[model samples]
Target chain A: MKKHLTIALDAMGGDQAPAVVVHGAHLARERYPDVHFVFFGRSDDVQPLLDAAPLLKKVSRFVHTDDVVQAEDKPGKALRRSRQSSMALAIESVKAGECDVAVSAGNTGALMALAKFILRTLPSIDRPALASLLPTYKGECVMLDLGANVECDASNLVEFSVMGAAFARTVLGLQRPRVGLLNIGVEELKGNEEVKEAAEILRTSDLPMEFCGFIEGNMIGAGETDVVVTDGFTGNVALKAVEGTAQLIGRLVGDAFRSSWRARLGYLLARRGMNGLRDHLDPNHHNGAVMLGLNGLVVKSHGGATVEGYATAIGVAIDMAHHNLIHLITKDLGGVAMDRQESEPLTLETDKQAESKSA
Target chain B: MKKHLTIALDAMGGDQAPAVVVHGAHLARERYPDVHFVFFGRSDDVQPLLDAAPLLKKVSRFVHTDDVVQAEDKPGKALRRSRQSSMALAIESVKAGECDVAVSAGNTGALMALAKFILRTLPSIDRPALASLLPTYKGECVMLDLGANVECDASNLVEFSVMGAAFARTVLGLQRPRVGLLNIGVEELKGNEEVKEAAEILRTSDLPMEFCGFIEGNMIGAGETDVVVTDGFTGNVALKAVEGTAQLIGRLVGDAFRSSWRARLGYLLARRGMNGLRDHLDPNHHNGAVMLGLNGLVVKSHGGATVEGYATAIGVAIDMAHHNLIHLITKDLGGVAMDRQESEPLTLETDKQAESKSA
Candidate 1:
């Protein structure tokens, strides 16, 4: 018999909490019958919601906490004051081995801060990166460092490439994912110092991955590479830009269809096609953004996500837990780090020297 | 009668070359009866195309130049060796006051490098930024520093905001355009030192524009502001991402419509609406990217743009020339720079001191 995958939930987090969290868990429970949930929030608020879903109630246990982290609470303030908060407690549950993975639809900064503080990073990882799967023309691709660290060095970027590739491999089921560094231009001489340095290291390093030197922003949606690595700032902006553009086009198409009776009739005939298009691009289908490099798994659902979206986030957590994603990432990272140490010790030393000099 | 606006064209540049250039000139001439053109390329290559368009030939003069700058030519190499090249001669015409503006569909880097070297920057401007129009939900908006300078300081961003606002006011016909600094987050403390410093400056400055504190990438397409100011690196990436997303959605929508007979029938009936959308989001409709801050007006058309796209680029040059865009930018910059100098001389001194100390 297989062991049930356990997931801790931050029930009081997102805009529409406890209710969506409970309902989402019920939906996920239907899909993964062998999954159990540990809900963290005020039991009074969560108990009533769970009472409606008997299946979810049967497999879920509530951990009562009166304190709740506000959406606007700064990362530092939350880390210091929100020890008993639902978000923090959920992450702590993962740290305590009570759950295999933690899922939160909370303030991103607060969640990331608490997860990092509680779980810490993998031994070879310097900083944890936020990674998500984005639908591309070719297929779905994984992009990393999505607003985790505002600024990242060459080493941080290299680490993100490894993590993102590992993610694409495990989540998307690619055998050997192609990784590319995001830059303004594809030329070797383009971009800032850090990107150039990262490319140089990736090109010469003994990392067991296909490193496609550099890719521009336009090529990202073209699925030119399976894994796209960038600093948190660029990654966040690029992701948002892609989302915005997709939404804008959707709106424009709707407006056009509504313009005339003929068009509206055409829309009726093409409703199925439109639904297919909508479903393909829907955020609910691509809900969870995993905080990679963390010792324990932490999946962050979009703050404004729906019940289905939350359920999808739970599904991602389940899949990752079942597959032992953290173990795979650690093994791959160790291999790459060891190879770099053996082959390019001088580069690593230079990086350390640069960091110390800056410090 | 209004005086005619003379535009110098790099007839040998772009993929389609003299054919598209000459045909585009004909289209522009039809739209603006008072416009004149100077074609710069090998006469044998350009003359035949011009002869076919008798109306364009009537208002155009041909300047023969056999030296063509290849698309792969490096910027530095182009600037040094391509003196008699069509692109160079066309810009020279603008510099010599023979043409009000110079339009090229040549290499972007080559055009920017040469334009900077020949036209030079305005006295108050430190760098020339590339600005372009983008379709937004609200209407149309302008974004600047597309790919001109890869790295920018606080002052460079401030200059871009000022220049971008001027472009919006003069070209887009906005009375007082709202200007925003692009960042990963909208919070005051978010982003790097340069962005934070620029925000601080813009917030307190006496620049005659409504300074929206910060805008995220998602809000750009929502048309949150009339002018979006960012560094060339971020700007270029964001622009490409937007384009990529649009194309990806287009492809997805196409695939969806083709999936079933019902969708095909619907598409046939809704063809008009789709056409409306196609025209709205078409890159051809938004063809020109102006190299702002240059002493002489230099418009860069997309290398692979269609005849209509090239004609639209010509229209942008005509609009800028008619509105005296550079003169307006210069005046506004002078006002802001003077106010800044009067109010924050210490800030300027501190910047210089920091630079020297770092040096």
Candidate 2:
């Protein structure tokens, strides 16, 4: 028999929380029969929802908590005051080894703050980054630092690149993922100081990954690389821009089809093809945004996600646990750390020499 | 008789130059009979192309220049060395008042650098911004600082807002345009110090425009505001991301319709509706990216634009000249400068009081 993996869920989070959370767990349970769940929310509110899902009820345990984190609560305030909230408790369960991974459809800032405060960062990791799989023309690619560290230095960007590579390898099952740094232009001297410095490091570093120079925002959709690394500010804006454009196109297409009877007839005949396109581009298929560089696994679902989207987030968490994502990241980051240490002294010497020459 | 506007064209610019430039000019001449053209390039290469279009040849004159700026030429290098090149001469014509505006499908960096060098910036404008019209749900909106300045301060952002509003009013014919700062979040406390500072100023200042606080990247396509303001780095990335997403969707839709015979039949029946969508979303329909805040109007066409796209770019330049865009920007910027001076003393006093308190 396969060993069962436990997932801790924030039952009282998201727009429609307890119902979608419970139903999503049942869907996940059906897909992965050896998975169990630990629900963190008020017992009275969650019990009725769980009762409807018999399979989930059989393999679930509950840690009742009356407290909840409001979506608009500040991250600092939530970290200090909402310790017993469902989102916080779910994170705590992962830290305590009661659950293999934690999944939450809650306030992103609050979840990140609580996860960082409770679970801590992995060794040699300065900051944790948010990563998600984005659909591209060639295939799916991983993009990192979605909104975690908004203003990142060269070191933070390098760390994100490493984390994103590990994610692409573990989740996407790629033997050697080609990573690229996201910049305004592909030229070496195109961006600001931090991005240029990061690109230089990635180009020269002796890491166990394929570094494909630099990629522009348009290249992200073209699937030019398996892993795209960027500072949180640009990454977050770029991700949303892509989503917005896709939605705008979909709306325009619908309006066009509805404008004429001939088009409506065409829609009926092409329903299967259109369905395939819709399924491929659906947000539900790519729901979870994983927080990397953490000691334990944490997946954040969109607060406005539907039942199917929430279930997909749960599925992402399961896959991470099944593949031992944390272990893969640690191993790759360990190599990065060693490489940095060996090169640091040489880099310092070079900098000092250049400064002396300029002086 | 209506006043005629003469446009200087860089005949040796873009991928398919000389031919496309002459053809595009002819198309523009057909649309606006009052517009004349002065083409700058080698006469040997340009005369044959001009001969093919009798109407254009009758209304156009050529300035012979053997030198041309390569696509890969460095902006600074081109500015210093390529003074006699076709692009430089076209810009010089605008500066000399020989032409109302200059249109180029050449290098963007080269054009910007030369335009800034020769024509100079408006009196109250510290940096010239790149503004382009983007299609939105409501109709169309203007976004600025596309790639002119990668790093911008609060003052620069405020200037972009004013410039963008003026562009919309002059070109899109909006009575009172709503301007918004593009940010990671709509909350007052989100984003970096520069953005926060800009928001505070826009919120408080009286600049003869509607300030809609902060709008996210997704709001760009939602038609949330008439002007979307952001730093050049973010603005450029967001614009390209939108274009890339549109292209990706177009590809996916084509693939979907070709998947089965039914879909193909549907495609034939729905061809008219699909054509409408294609026309609306075509880059050729919106081909002009104007360099705003310059003393003279300068329009940058896509480097790889076809004849129709090039013609559309010429149309944009003509509209800007006809509406007196520079005069509108000067008037708006004059108001902004007055507001700044009125608030400077009070801001200085507040800063001193805060410093004294800290001491």
Candidate 2 deviant stretches above 4 angstroms:
A337-359, B337-359
Error of 1 at A91 (Å): 0.4
**Candidate 2: residue A107 lDDT (0-100):** 93
Report the poorest 10 consecutive residues by lDDT, candidate 1 chain A: A335-344
Tens digits of per-residue lDDT, candidate 1, A1-359, equal 24788899999989899888988999999999989999999989999898888888999999999999999999999999999999999999999899999999999999999999999999888778999989889878898888998778777888898888878877888878899998888999888777887898787766657999989999889999999999898888889989999989989999989989988998999899899889878988888999999889999999888999999999888878888888888777664533444435655665686487346
- Tell me how far the alpha carbon of residue B322 in candidate 1 is from the true structure, in angstroms, after superposition: 1.6
Fnat of every candidate, listed in order = 0.81, 0.71
Pairs of residues clashing in candidate 2 = none
Interface Cα RMSD in Å, per prediction: 2.7, 5.5
TM-score of 2: 0.93
| Model 1: chain B TM-score relative to the native chain B | 0.93
Give the Cα error of residue A289 in candidate 2, in Å: 0.5
